[model samples]
Target: MVSTIVWGTGNIGRAAIRAVAAHPALKLTAVLVNDPAKAGRDAGELAGLGRRLGVAASTDVEAALAAAPRAVVYAASGDLRPAEALADVVRAIRAGAVVVTPSLYALYDRRGAPPEASEPVLAAIEAGGGSLFASGVDPGWANDVLPLLVSGLATTMDAVRCQEIFDYTTYDQPDVVRYLVGMGQPMDYRPPMLAPTVPSMVWGGQIRLMARALGVELDELRESVARRPLDDTVTTAAMGVFESGTQGAVRFEVLGIVGGLPRIVIEHVTRIHPSCAPDWPQPHSGAGSHRVIVEGRPRIEVTVEATDEDGNRAAGGNATAVGRLVGAIDWLVEARPGLYDALDVPLRPAIGRLGRRGV
Candidate 1:
């Protein structure tokens, strides 16, 4: 069995920890936390497992690597500090551990990433003779893997559009709230979109992944952001941290082109406050569903309605993500060393259950 270490203690971290703990092919070795205060706590308790694994949370990277884990699941914080988080993955790879992450910001399109941000990690993985791959549910699945899967049904293709819509109201994580809806802050406090030069880190690689998989070479990419306010003051458990109601909805779209011609359009929406548009698609107003429309000779339109087994809409698409990650771990370990996106990897259905029904 390959011994594995899990990093972080947040939502994805917790889900990954549970996945590692139950995998037959993996041995749970350690849990690493950046916070000094969380050090020495049981990995299981930190993940709400109730049972202890004899492994404690830690901040010392070298010590964790000294334990000689075969692999490390770098499920750390994914935010503006993605480069820093990837630095940790680089260290793990240098120690001879295969690293797999869902950080979502690691150089999806190598050309777009700053050399300072990406080169060191690639160099370390190369020098260590280990492998690294990053992917999340939406970018990993809906845009890349799903589109590739759908392409199998077509004899010829022209354009592909992938849309991911999910309700932000049920998601209670602060970082998630901030990343999706820009909650707890005023519109003026929002960062400026840098146009074609730099798009939001979230979907840059996703757009590129889709384009490359569909055999479309993009010449130009454009991004636009739109927002709407909440009808009234709202409250939730994420309150104080992410004040409810004032800022209700936000949408971000990226259009990819080949020779200045549009080939793909990727759109992301977050609605914490309720609003309606006449053009918005039905069933939660473009929330809680993923639609991929392909225009080609065959003209295939596929709509994947994401819902829990009980039929309630899931939040953040994390279940699908965790399931895919758990299923992909074995393949990721055997993958060649270098940076890779979803389309470069293979994902398949599996019997190893990882996600909790209610969470």
Candidate 2:
């Protein structure tokens, strides 16, 4: 069993803790948290695992790394603190811990990522002789693994579109919902997530990764965005009220054009409420679904719905992202020290550590 430490305590971090505790090949050694309030807290309690796992959360980076964990799941949020998150991951890597995370978005498809963003990671990997892998639900699985697997069944593929259609009311991140995603803001307010070049910077790599898997070079990477205002006031348990005339729904697509045609597309249709978009595609299950549509001879459409313990699709999606990162731990440790993206690693389903008592 590989000794592992979980970093961070946000949505992804909580899920990683649950995963690490349940994995058969992994022994949860320590958890790293930047928040002093969370310091010395039981790992199980932090993860909502019901029973105590004897591991306590620590605020000391050097001390946690000193434990010499074979792997570390760096689950901290990079949305707001990209540089800090990068530094944290590098610190873990330089300490000889194989690191996996969804924090660094640019690392999702590192080939297309800028040198300044990815080079430091490579340097750290070389310095520590430890590997690194970055992945998440949308850029992680929905675009890379799912699309490539679905495309394999198609003898003649014309276009591939991967979509994340979900209602975001269940998600509890207020800053991200209001500021980053433009929720509860005036229609004129442009969220940083949809700002010029940001979508291209975040999702463009996923498109490029898809193209690379199919052995096709994209002529261009294009971005398309559309927003809808709420027709009436809406309320959610997680986020407060969103008044009418404010941004309620958003739909955006990152298209990879080949020979002047969009051959590969990564689309996101997110809304604060289900009633917001009558015409937009709806999730087939409880919350939302990740749909992969291959348009060609014998067109194929596959919809995937995932849920967490309480049946919250948002949390389930986060868990899947955590699983992708943690599941790759064993494979990553065995591989040579380097920066790895979704395309570089096989989607080995980490199963042994699942279904522990009350987990």
What is the alpha-carbon RMSD of candidate 1 to the true structure? 3.7
lDDT of 2 at 30: 92
Question: For model 2, which pairs clash?
Answer: 22-353, 23-353, 24-353
Q: Which candidate is the best by TM-score?
A: 2
lDDT per residue, candidate 2, 1-359, as tens digits?
A: 89999998888889999988777778899999989999999999999888899998999889889878899999888998999989998888888989998888788887878887888888988888877888864537988898899999998999999999989888888998899999889998989999988988888888888889999988988899999999999999898999999999999988899999999998999999888976988888667878899998779999878888588888888898888888888888888889888899999864664455536
Query: On a 0 to 100 scale, what is the lDDT of residue 261 in model 1?
Result: 70
Could you tell me the lDDT of residue 124 within candidate 1?
88
Model 1 segments more than 4 A misplaced:
50-54, 110-114, 137-139, 179-181, 192-201, 240-245, 275-287, 297-299, 305-316, 351-359
Error of 2 at 341 (Å): 1.2
lDDT value for candidate 1?
0.68
- What is candidate 1's CA lDDT for residue 12? 69
Q: Give me the displacement of residue 325 in model 2, in angstroms.
A: 1.1
